[model samples]
Target: MAQTTAKYHCLVTGFGPFYRYTEEENPAWLAVKPLTNSIIEDEQNNVRPIHVSTLQLPVSYQAVMDVVPLLHSHPPVFHPSIAEQAARNGVARPQKGYDFILHVGVAGRGALRVERVAHKFGYNMKDIYGRQAPVVETAPLPVEPEEPGDVPEEVLHISAPQIEQNQLELAEGPEPTPEPIRPKRGFGPGYENFQEEVYSDVNVVSLIRNMKQQNFEDVYLSMDAGHYLPDFIYYCSLAEVIRSVKPYERRRGTQVLVVHVPPVGQPLTSEQVTTALKLIITWVCSELQSIDDTLAKERFQ
Candidate 1:
């Protein structure tokens, strides 16, 4: 038997036309459109060959919600014209899971922004289709998980007579009614307990530093992704990752990141924006590999 080399996979997405930007003027999708089905590598970071798949997301909340889950489970690869030939040649196809998923959108500002968090609700704005996002109420703050060491040291011992009296009183009282379950509004049901805000565990500070080192001077770590389609998609993607993965590994939301890029020639050309995106994808792939390696080591220890 021969050893098989590990291959990394990533999905980078850009937005379609919206507002004043026409189909041809949308810089976000234009920058990434050429890199579809390309491969990126970073020898310095020990990253393997990352197969990149690109998607141009529509400027609609509903469309984004429909596609976000597929990205994590089974997304369509953006293959070139030679895809049929390659398939016939028996080349291996990419699998279901992605090492990282990056969503890119246009921002009014001239700088490149790596968003740190996305809000779960407050998306009151309309999409390109003149449709508003699902109006969801604010979610409650997340409760912290308790560890085994945090258990109480003392336990109350109930007397047999007290227990009998309590049981008799319960039997005498009317039966309690069960509360009806209300299905959440956004992205179907089962998300009633989602957090109000989801944070990406990706190191945005390091990402900004790396962008600056690569001559992208205007790069910044952004706290808010705004309440538009971009933020809506980010929340959808993050929430999907949290729902699919285990609670302990919920921070795997780090594997899903969103970037806000400025319009073309807003102090940066399309070429520069494309270069920055490539760099971002490379860095994220390396970071995810590092996390997996650390978890593997901890498991053995």
Candidate 2:
């Protein structure tokens, strides 16, 4: 008989949307009820596909920090719901820091398709107010295609000559155009006002900074914010967030990756489980590899 070793579980966190006041909405926190019992079924089996910890926090950073201490540090929060998830499960606080912290939430502004922006800005990590200094702002302009016959994009830039002329006209117009669209000043979708939303973080900025500082060759951030960021920009008065650290000099550098989330409405029926096992196994295995690399280095080595 083979001896079974306990697997290291993750702590996942989410928050309710308080700032978003509307009819018939429970905020992102409502998703936790379903997320808790419904295991993160990895149909692809990329490694360890299951999310061991799943919990939610309010949109408020302080409320989130009431549970997880690390998240309380500063503006861009780390996985704010991890502590709640760990407690939700019977597992005592681990003897060490979490093997991984997975935070899941609704990406509100994701409706618009901005693969190029997501890809261009890389992780798109921003500050608490959603504005970063040194970044020039201008009205949205037509994106130049990367290649001929290619699609256009909306990467941030402030070099528009027309925006200069156009904003002048608009500013001189009716009361609405006094302030041109700008960071924290609102220039993107749904932001017609002189102000915009707050900027939160999944820690891509610090994580990238750390990787760069360490000169880690193969570290890449996995992301899932999708196109929702823009929508959030409108109601939240938030700015697009991205890491500020430059990767340390190295032969090779860190590359952040965005993972695709499985579609909603997963059924826990036996039929699905049987077919989905392969994917589950693969995801678990990949996660296992990540773990083995750090905690189980000897085994992997």
Candidate 3:
């Protein structure tokens, strides 16, 4: 069997509006500096450099074009466009060629609570758009598979007809050769389960899709005014992309890229940055070690 070989290079794009975060000295393009500039190391002193890049695009459809070329899976024959250049260097004309593209930005979910924050109470529960959201359904209790003596009920799959119709209507595009840059997952030694907090936030993109009829650029610019996404949502999106590459190895892949986003126009505290950096390191190291472990099990067999 031939092993896959393609260099993994990540292009991390952050937002640079008219201004930067308050704690920063320079006109910073990114909100979270920890995510952009970093070095990954091991006990043996082997190091892999992580490269970061930022973009300054007006929150518009043009921003979406900046990353689309990078997503080509194959020959990577870039259809050169001026927008690509503007995306990469804020002015350079974008030319064909790039391995992978990643972008992170902030959203204005807090604005939803701002008006309420001024009131006597903490804040109202409506989203940024002022619509009161209903109580979200929690995860249902997992029902274990039937025991050996138990009779299994007939399987019932609730499929969507519209989805099926869409599938039929969907057309295949040019296939790009898959170059996987799977990122590692899980926490590293020490700082495990650090300051975990659960909060409810809507995927504003979904709302935009409903309102604008699936215009991501409109939604992105409107919600992500400063262009930073919530960290967890960015992580989830990153994981989804990786899993799409090799669904079987979803739990056991290295090179997991987590795009750490921050609130608009602010730098995270040192402690917060430290925790994020530590978790990323742990994931990379664990994934590297587990390659042999997964190989021994021969699940790929």
Candidate 4:
């Protein structure tokens, strides 16, 4: 008898509009909306289709808390109030738990950043409602910041031209542009000062490599998922994954990743961003299939 392959499911999330960017649409949602219910075919002929389930999360910190727990649960439940149509359509819960949970948000400026690590701590910056996260908290695991030098030249160059163009526009403005904000070396006061980082469970390096191989542009690995809503969601989701498992037992949990996109009116269009997203999703499903096949062989051996 021929063997049947397992279907892979992904939960892609994007943030809704916030008060700060009232006039402009959040690019995350704009990019993600096109992908919901989309079926991506594997480059290899034999693999089954990869199903994408997308969600538009509210900008509230409270919503992050409420929604993430549901995702972490076994056979995740979708409350009717969240989005009745989406819930009924299987967007809320996958028949088999999600293989990947990708959170997308706007990074204000920069190229398409495939974030490497999400810190447990949040900064003094407020959310959409002017609410702030606690200054410090115990990280689920320790993490070190990646050196800027380690970033690939190809990735760095992705946003160079656009950034330069923006600088020129700001230079010609009525008021002088302020100096660009540089990354801080150490954690600010109140925390132990150690780098408390949790990396994305997804194979970001391989993911980016695949994108480059396929001729995709402007995609880079980012070390910082700044202390804002994106970082909060990434950290919280990762924490839930870890918490779901037994303390000291090794198990393959859901693969979690946060992708930061540039703000609207940037050089890249919605189509370009959406294409990049589809490519990443395809790559992730392919990687997960390979892993599953390897594990199956090991079990039978």
Say which candidate scores most in TM-score: 4
Candidate 1, poorest ten consecutive residues by summed lDDT: 85-94
What's the lDDT for candidate 2? Answer: 0.35
Superposed by TM-score, candidate 4 places the C-alpha of residue 158 at a distance from the truth, in angstroms, of 57
Order candidates by lDDT, high to low: 4, 1, 2, 3
Q: Give a tens-digit lDDT track for model 1, residues 111-180.
A: 8888999987667677899988775555678999987667665424567888899999999999989898
Q: What is the lDDT of residue 77 in candidate 2?
A: 31
lDDT of 2 at 164: 90
Writing each residue's lDDT as its tens digit, candidate 2 over 92-138 gives 24343344333334332212111111211221333233423223245
* Candidate 3: tens digits of C-alpha lDDT, residues 1-301: 3323322333444444423333242222333345443334343423233333334333222232334333333323223543464444432122322223334444322211100000111112332333322222234579998775575343234358866775666645455578984332221222132232221122333333343442212222131111122232233323333433455553332232323334533344333433443333333343444453467558557
**TM-score for predicted model 1 compared with the true structure:** 0.73
lDDT of each: 0.75, 0.35, 0.33, 0.75
Which candidate model has the greater TM-score, 1 or 2?
1
Candidate 3 versus truth, CA RMSD in Å, comes to 20.3
lDDT digits (tens) for residues 1-301 of candidate 4: 3545556788888888776555237899889888888777874645567788888887766677767768767787764446674764457366556888889988866579998888865455767777666434333566678798988887677777888998899888889668985333223343353246877778899899988898887889988888778887887788777667676643467888999999765767878888999888888877777777787778789
The candidate 3 region of ten consecutive residues with least summed lDDT is 112-121
